[model samples]
Target: MATCTVALTAIDSSSRQSLEYSSANQSPESDDEAPRMSLLRKLAVIIQLSGVNFASSAVNGLVVVGLPTITADLKLDPSLAFWPTSVSSLANASTILLAGSVADSIGPRPVNIAGGVVTGAFILAAGACKTGPQLIVMRALQGIGYAMHLVSSVAIVTHTLPRGRPRNFAFSCLGLSQPLGFSFGLVLGGILQDLIGWRAAWYIYGGLTLALSVVAAWALPNFQNEGTFKGTMRNLKVRVDWVGALLASIFMTLLSYLFAIRDPKSIVFICLIAMSLPLFVGWVHRQVKLGKPALIPNALWKDTAFSSICGTVALSFGVTTCMELFASLFFQEVQHLSPLQTGLRIMPSLLVGVALNVTTGLFVHRVPALWIVTVSSIICSVAPLLMAVIKVQSPYWANAFIAQVLAPMSTDVLFTVGLIIISDNFPDNTQALAGAVFNTASQLGQALTLGIMQIVSTLVTKDYSDKILPMARLEGLRASFWTMFGFMMLCTLWGAIGLRNTGRVGLKRD
Candidate 1:
């Protein structure tokens, strides 16, 4: 049987070559090469890609508003309620690099379609889950699919659009989709939970995903490497470093576990978490030794601008996600707001984010990304600090509203500028990988920092009863906000000092 299998494989390879030769000899009209795509086609593709991103972001937004409802419905321990969100982020962080590599090795089209279908299936499955564990597992699967979709979608945009105004505009639209989708999901989830149940929110997400999967299959162009199938397969087989992949996965898993685990104060867990640093360092060294087929090439590390941008993204975005999670809890438990009310309250920030992203997308090409990131980071810190100082009876307009407006502006600017920097720095071949790394940093930042903040909050407000007074709970939340403020300020400093000025117009590639 083995002998026959090998023989069949060899025969298939030879047949593929024959087909390639025949196709190569075909007439010139058989392949009408267009140097540039029509503007309409470009817009259509960008819209579709952005739509997919919107779907993913909407799902994340649903989790934000739906989490309290889910916890109540499932009769979950409040401490464990965070698992649903953290699991998804953990899965995405761990698998993103591999997904990017696959997209690069094959093509973005297949990865995008497959990711959407898988995400839809798992999310639908999650809607019917009876236990917290089941829901967490399903969400993790959804995260894997989301990672594939995100990496490929970003790569497609970078690959399709040239590196100037069109690319910048496309990236801005892509960034804008996140806040828009998130806002839509927040409102939709709350409305659905009020009308039907929290489960309905998952159903909606699943249905949309399945529909988008079909649309993507039709709309996405096959920009696979131009070569015989056999040759492409051979290249993929030889270039994929399985050892590096395994090590990286192990490293990411340990790091994620270190952050996501609820009992951060446990001595054993702390030791285990501490061990991951050495493993990570070793993984980097191995990648350096492995050279070409490395999971993360050395060239990426050499790019100081890329490193600075990624660090800034992780810090700033991490704080943003943590703030949203905690703020949702505060609105529901402390202020005793309904899910719908919480969504409505947060709408202004999302709207501001969308508007800012649009404006940035239109004109960011004229400014240095470093300056945008630095100025935004400084302004963004004020929101959390303001939140930390707010009293229970503070006026909404004086405190929450102002903070909300400022928060989104920073997030939008930082995200758009970071994407622009990445898109400009990396070549077409590694665009997917670049997107994956950037997203991984964001996810890990969320997972790790949020975990730390939760621990800090717990420790500071240990005397407060979780089941009792709202004021007690507010104390811990305030502590977390202070921590968030500190981190944001540090990110501001990093941006100011570390990021290089890339000139006034377009990206300055190092």
Candidate 2:
């Protein structure tokens, strides 16, 4: 696999070079401008971009911490309660590719502002939802907005910062926002649940998003596709692959819907999953035929570095998310901790992540990203394995705390490094696409894997009702950890074998 990936990398490099040579004669609109802002101004822009990431992460974290309260308050069937998170992830996974394509064509600034507005509105509306179905609809809309925010935020960062130290630093700060926001959400969600009620979490999230929208409008630059086409409707229509985007969205939506449905035995669900396979194949074929305007250009598959990193990142994200969800349940149900206590207990991991985020940013360009991934993979694998051994009577400091700390160390490092690798390999034209693919994989990984794991947990724990013995339900949670352990082991092997030890931007390659 490593050898095959290396060969593909070579092919992709040569092909990209050839393509660039052929396009050399084209007229230029404007290449990326060199950064001219003072350090304070640059930091302010970074804060704005990172704030978008922070808002998204905060929402996700709130879901994780507040799900139990939501389930109880909304009178949701325990089995169906996962829908709020799963549905949002499904919507995000389905739309992100199209969002990235749109960002590339129209520029990131508009997407950022528009996405923030939509996300804020939907989240605020979600606070008023009276039924599970209403919440699902609002969450799905919020997901679309999040997809826009995610892809465009990364594009803006990559576009604004040149390769090397500044870009690395910016990327690291963006990465840091995820954990920072997540930690804040966990605490805030717990407080709201205890004080004002779970609905307050949504109100706070919505308010933050609205503020970020204003910041994005003021901070983001409106960089166009340099020399690609004039701002005419005909040219715009020709440049954007509407058909490809539609097909890709349909395929992902079908795929996500298949996983979201609880009934694996349902003929309709099975048929949808089966149908998506062909739709996906057709989308790939369409992209191949369409060339430049394709939602996902054919050239991306040939870029071995990008492809490998995407796969590894997806799997890692899936396992990590699954573990987090299960752990949250374990803390609340088996250990009988309050939501606030659970949030506080999870803090050590975020602290570790903060330190590593800084370390990764400062050293990523000096180190080979694959090495960081490989080491993190190994550590991540052990964390889940430890969780699998934990019992209802296990000590918090000895079992849960250690795993939390080790787990985030791996996830935070991998996430930061993964973004850096994606930004480094792709050119400016496809930066948004690359970001979209990266984030889509992360969201899909969470949605699909968590869906599967939820089903497994339900089945595994069904024999012992929570009414009979609360600790009995943990049997399934432990099983999920073991399953995550297996996935992490696979990620470790893939990182070691399939991934190349590529140095970050401007580093000397041996």
Candidate 3:
């Protein structure tokens, strides 16, 4: 895995060269008066970035929304069926650094385009798979493509755009991608799966992504020898920790595996902790001592701002992912809503998240990021705690809907603040790695939450029959909320202390 520190060093050196070259040749007045990009061009960039986000997030949403359907259709064990999603996430988390390195060697544009194409191809192939093994294989490939697209897209935004209005607006544009795509995917995936089947849904998603890949290849700018894109591919010296990557992948796989085994609560807990815990600890130690190019750099551990923001992002994602996963189960099993109905109900939260992201983009340069993050964290903590108080007979408006709304509003605000905080702290060159760090943390957080929730939900249901009623299942879900609420509190306190109050203009890179 590529560390943010190494990436930062590369970005800083290139930016310094650009500044020096500009000072030597251009008059200060002329440099200041260089023509600003038009509204149309800016919009074009935003659209492209959003498109990139759309493709990646939509795929994730599809996997999440369609997982149960796939399991039923294939008659596979839920744990076995889950590998398609879990392995894909692992592939994505593990491959980001290699993708970042590729972005540094080549321009971000081609890398983004290539990723889009590969994602399209693999998703289509996944749809065609007839067996679980084939589907898992295809999903793993799709994960690799997702890692490439995300890393390249962020790098392109960081390198190609100027640092003020354009960058902020681009951040807003990129931010719109996940929530909106997820919202749209859930609704559409449900509808499509109902009417045309899940396989057809995958086909449609693949085709749409293919179209975006083509447009991106044509419309996006290429950076070759440019300041942010500066690199000598022929002499690239950074090494990758293949062994560490392998161990990390295995550790994550085994951890998820332990969770999937439906065993006695105490036995499952003991087994997972005894086996996977030590494996992970060993992986971390190996990365620290034996890694040549460490998967994640140790230097980043010392950077307060970077570590805090990464933790914030991880917690935010953990809360959001767990909520979405459990809530869908609640609606289907407890509330008696069909998947289609559940998707429709969830649409508002997704839309609200998009609106908040765009709004955050506009206000990031004006408001203190610390304030936004803190407020969002407070909202997250309060919402779930409120939801936990509701009785089985409580109205949706009084408890469920209010909790749902807060989730998106809180997540959007918190995620945007953390993104800006991390982006500002890392140098432009390392911006891609910074994104990888943030995203990896985000995915890992989600995975951990899922594992934890699986345990909680299973244990709570043991007193009941295997065919647990929805309302009864919800009672178990309330236990998980306590965990999420604790995460929010920790993040809130961390943001309050760690996020710096840079001047309310352009943010300063640490």
Candidate 4:
């Protein structure tokens, strides 16, 4: 198998000959230089990365929407079934900073290739598991692989492409690819699970990932050697606050655990929160006072563009994810829809998500980032507010469906905008940091929203029917929509007041 992998890699590399010229000024204008297919190579890179996105999305959609199915099939407890995704989240969050450092020290090419290999391997392994514990362990490893792949891919995209409208467009296009994967996963995974089985979906995704890994080895540009050991050693000499990393991880883990347990008023959970909260806060302050390169760089956090983008990502993403997951529940459990039926039911919003993703990428160069974000946030909030007002007798084609369509447009539009802003703001040296932070915010925000919505939904349904009737479910669903409404409104306010207005095109380096 290993030999086969290497042979495949070799074949891929031979198909696409890339010429790396030394100087920054080197261009394709010269006749003698092995004719640089920069455009072709960039296209190849985007296509390759889009495959990675598809694989991850396929698996995640299975995990998220297939939760009810997986739990029932495996005979696992409903609550514990969250372990696969929770483990994935924990591992992803833990590995990103370390991977960022590694990517910066070593060129992104090797790290990216390594991640592709591991991601394919682990995703395949996940399919072979029979029990929840085994599944969680494999998923966690996959998370590590994902962090490496994501950081490496984004670093390559941001650094390899010159910083300008082209780079901004690439970032937006990549963000757009996210929804393509997600939408495909939802519709396709549901079809596969019904026609064959849920486990088959995993195996199929694994095959796709393995095939894409080979393409990556061939078409993606090799990591440009940005100089030697001396450059890396200089960065290593700068202090890395290991203590800060540990503290932050501890806080993140504990907070997530607390949220998972959904015991907001529990003394034990409250005490853990109380103790960890202050320690995490104090540690961040100490890192700043000592001028150390903490788990999160103080300088990066202080950048208005970076911070604004992060906030927008957190809230906007939180709403989209929460709405999607619970909407599945609303359709499946409340309205008694089939899994395929539920997937079809949500098509309005999901389809709109894909459309906006593509449109935003195409026009991002001509629009202001701030205005795009603000308008999207407002649209997102209004979509949910419209849903919140839906009556039990309301038809899908009425305000509910219209709101759903409008809802995801804003969510996807802001996603592209946020990615463009962050990619443009960070230095080439910090490409991994930029990717890690953006993904981290998006992922954590999703996780946080799921947990919070669980609590709010439970509260609203506490006194309701035993079978979770549609009327009761609708009430609980409204509460969740209100939560999303609040989040998107906040995103709008922050984007308006806090973000530094920048061109729709990416910023040029000083």
Candidate 5:
């Protein structure tokens, strides 16, 4: 809390000239956040924010669970099937940095509601699509809206809630919504795919999103800023680092696109990817020289602890998402289970995620972050290995159910702790950007790991003469699991070394 005050106090008077009349940047734990609220009001706000995450994640589960049917029905090109699952992430990562700046310039409430509306609109549009390309485009648009909501929601929660256990619990609820929603989607998507069709599930989820949007419009806090629309836009033009944002977005977009492809070896592709790094670095340097608002300052990464957090964030997210998807595929494609059975098999992950999230939020203030993350990551690393070595004839109780229970432990823990540490490091006014940086790491991990694991799985599958056989595909999936285990181990090592000095985060300073 003192840290927040110090940062806010450092902003010089001259810099305040362009400040908008918005409540974009408020101190976490400020008494101004209302020292207390009624229980019912708190519930409405948490539900509205957390529900957004649930709806988005549920739809993602639908896509992953129903991929086979969707591909077959839409006559999607085999090469393009991966796009629907991943394109939204690419777009989300690309725009989130900018969205963070926008959220800060304006208020979070409008941004939150607008994002919900756009996300719902696109989800509905996606359901009505008749072609793979159409679905891919619509999902891409959803990413943009989701980015708006996610970044703004972080700002909202940080400013609206009293910091400490209350704030911690609220974030935990937000974290819980994602995996729980995804699991619901898995079961619901499975049931819908079997009983009716995947499209109906999308329709239902999309409608739920719009309803949530209405709630957000009414329930979210409306912070007052100083300037009119014209003044705000003018300030955005001058204060926001568009060049820095563009450079970062371009690099991420290019790299993510390359990852989505099966064979991406063109010299042009390689050169552009290579060039994007140095160019982005140079641009950041330029931003520093000009004393401008950089999207993400280069110096921020110099802190070994912060850098390590970002690295571990990527690996943890990558491994967890990989496990969820591949486990689903292994159940259906390798074990020859029906979609409903596959969804049921993955239910343990959802249950564990819910418990881990709430538990972490409750006790995080009492323990050192280093111990929490490193130990849990070590536990999680074992999950992929369990799946890798399991026999086809093994019962669910033997290793499969245990793996599902363990897969999500570290990720849910890291998300809560990481967000706290990362948010603390940033200026009080840049809370949305803090959220953006954290999420960008998660999205990047998912994009790169999923692509790399996909390639590894494909190559290993092709190593056998009869690659199409379930037995051979099982070997390939096992190879991917092995790859995930390796990454999870890396996450554990990095977290242990990086967060060694990170004492308990989210402690009350009031």
Candidate 6:
């Protein structure tokens, strides 16, 4: 009862706090500068923004599909094999807050362009690497660049474009581009692995992304006026909440590292990771009391809708990421499929994602967010459930294909809706931080699930010592699949209660 009262109080305060801009449809003509944005220019800007997502996400896909080939050629240590796949996410999770905070203060244009350049250069460097460690380092560096691009891209969309059809379609495209790029990577990685090399894939990705960055220069609007370099630096020093930012980053970075390494022996990492939360809480309390800017306003979580969306996004995205990785692993290891075959099998999810994103964009304003999120959560739960009970000899069409289609249902929907809700919860001016906070939740979920799933798989697989290696691996995957199922169900239940009052978002406004 006490907690509920506090939550309600926070909700009331937050209602007064956040201006619900993203869900209310203000047409493109609302802003004077918006009228001058020609259709061709709009399309170009959309491509430039969404293109970055596609390219960065493709790196993750390529890593997953091409891991065996990459490891073998680069002579990656057996122990560090997964690092290449996980490190990019790790890096992204660690620094996203800082990137968002900086972008919000200085302007997103510089940050976005710099990120693109860094991402392309690092990817190219990754391609040129001969050592596994070098590749991992480059991937980590590129992830930071991706953090810059990802956060800024969202700010650019939310701030520059008005709140109606143009913005809706753009957000939808942003959601679509991620899975689309991942699917593209899976197919492209396999083809390159078989014919040329994984290096060639990186070269292609890097070059194209660099080209997109160049286009983005002229394409993206100056929604937030740019400050001089000296002025920007000074603003960052004074306006930014450095203590809150530091506490948040340390917590995220340390916890993620512990999760990734999973060293039961590292008591120190465990203790520090545990300590970060309270310190962050203290910082938040200070910010709210002092009436200063916070990295993530402490009051935001008091709203049932925002909190629920954050939880759902973390779990849903984590599961989606896990499904993609584990599904590929299942196809290859349990069924003994080839890399190309594994990539082909996962293509169904991408098609579903594209379709859902488009549909959600067009009709989201007319539908209740509660129904959209909860129903999709129920449907996507089946994807992991299929894998949890599947037989080795099961036909791909009978089981895997359906799972693929179901896997993306909730997440793709949530990507657009969650962004809407998140954008709604934050002030319009702090779009970059909102993007960072949203992405941080997403990346945090990925980090948590990846770490936890890997742990589950490892422990479960170890118990099946009497079984053959393939059988043991299958058992591990099943355990993780069950874990994924639980996550989706929780997401569904959370939404059912939390979003009961969240009606028809994205409605047209003046």
> Could you say which candidate leads in lDDT?
6
**406 Cα displacement, candidate 2 (Å):** 0.9
In candidate 5, which residue ranges exceed 4 Å CA deviation?
Answer: 1-30, 35-39
Model 3 per-residue lDDT tens digits across residues 1-510 = 132233323333434433433423222322221123333443455576677577667766777777778777766665576576666766776677667655654556777888888888998998898877888889889988888888777776666544554456566667778888887778888899888888877887789888888778666664542233224433144434455555555555555455556656647556655675456456656667864455555566677767877777777877887777666766666776777887876676786786788777667778866677777888877766766676666777787787778877556775656666666655555566556666677776666666677777667765555554665577677777777788788878887777765335344232
Backbone clash count for every predicted candidate, in the order shown: 0, 1, 5, 0, 4, 0
Q: Residue 457 deviation, candidate 4, in Å?
A: 1.3
Q: How do the candidates rank by TM-score, highest first?
A: 6, 5, 2, 1, 4, 3
Better of 1 and 3 by TM-score: 1
Candidate 6: worst 10 consecutive residues by lDDT? 21-30
How many angstroms is residue 502 displaced in model 2 relative to the true structure, after the best TM-score fit?
A: 3.9
Write the number of the candidate with greater TM-score, choosing between 1 and 6: 6
lDDT tens readout by residue for model 5, 393-441: 8898898999999999889998898888887778767777888898899
The candidate 3 region of ten consecutive residues with least summed lDDT is: 25-34
Per-residue lDDT for 1-510 in model 1, tens only?
342233334433332332232232222211221123443444556666777778778878888898977877877676687888788888888888888877777777788889989888988988888988788899899999989998898777666544445456667777888888888888999998999988887888788888878877766766745357786687567655555565566567677777656553656656764675566556667767856566666567667677777888889888888777787777887888898988887788787887888778667878777788888888889989888988877767888887777777667787777876665566556677778888888878878887778787776677676646788888889999999999998888777766775654343221
Q: Deviation in angstroms for 120 in model 5?
A: 0.9
Off by over 4 Å in 6: 1-30
Q: If both were scored by TM-score, which would come out higher, candidate 1 or candidate 5?
A: 5
lDDT: the better of candidates 3 and 5: 5
lDDT tens digits, residue span 1-510, model 4:
342243324323422323323334322221121134344555667777767876876687777667778777767766675676566766776666667656755667767777877887888898788887778888989988888888877777665554444455556556666666766677777888789877887888888888888888877664444347787566555634556656655665666566677544666766776787577667868878877665565566677777978877877877887777776776676667777777776677666766686667657767777788888888778777877787756677886677767767666886667766675556556677668777777766766776777778767876565644677877888898888889888989888866655655554332
Candidate 5 lDDT trough over 10 residues, lowest sum: 11-20
RMSD in angstroms between candidate 6 and the native structure over all alpha carbons:
7.5
lDDT by residue (1-510, candidate 2, tens digit) is 342233334423332333332233221211223233344445557777778778778877888899888877778766578988788889998899888878877777788889889988998998888887788789999999989988887787666654445556667777788888888888889888889888888888789889978877766665745234456355357766777677677767876776666664657766766776566667767767846566665566676666777778888888877777788889998888999998998877788878988788767777666688888888878778888899888889888888888887666777767787676566667677778888887888888788778877777888666555575678888778888888888887777765674554433122
List of clashing residue pairs for candidate 5: 21-225, 21-226, 21-227, 22-225
lDDT of 6 at 217: 88
Structural RMSD, model 3 = 7.0
Clashing pairs in 1: none
TM-score for each of the candidates? 0.87, 0.88, 0.81, 0.84, 0.92, 0.93
- Write down the TM-score for model 4: 0.84
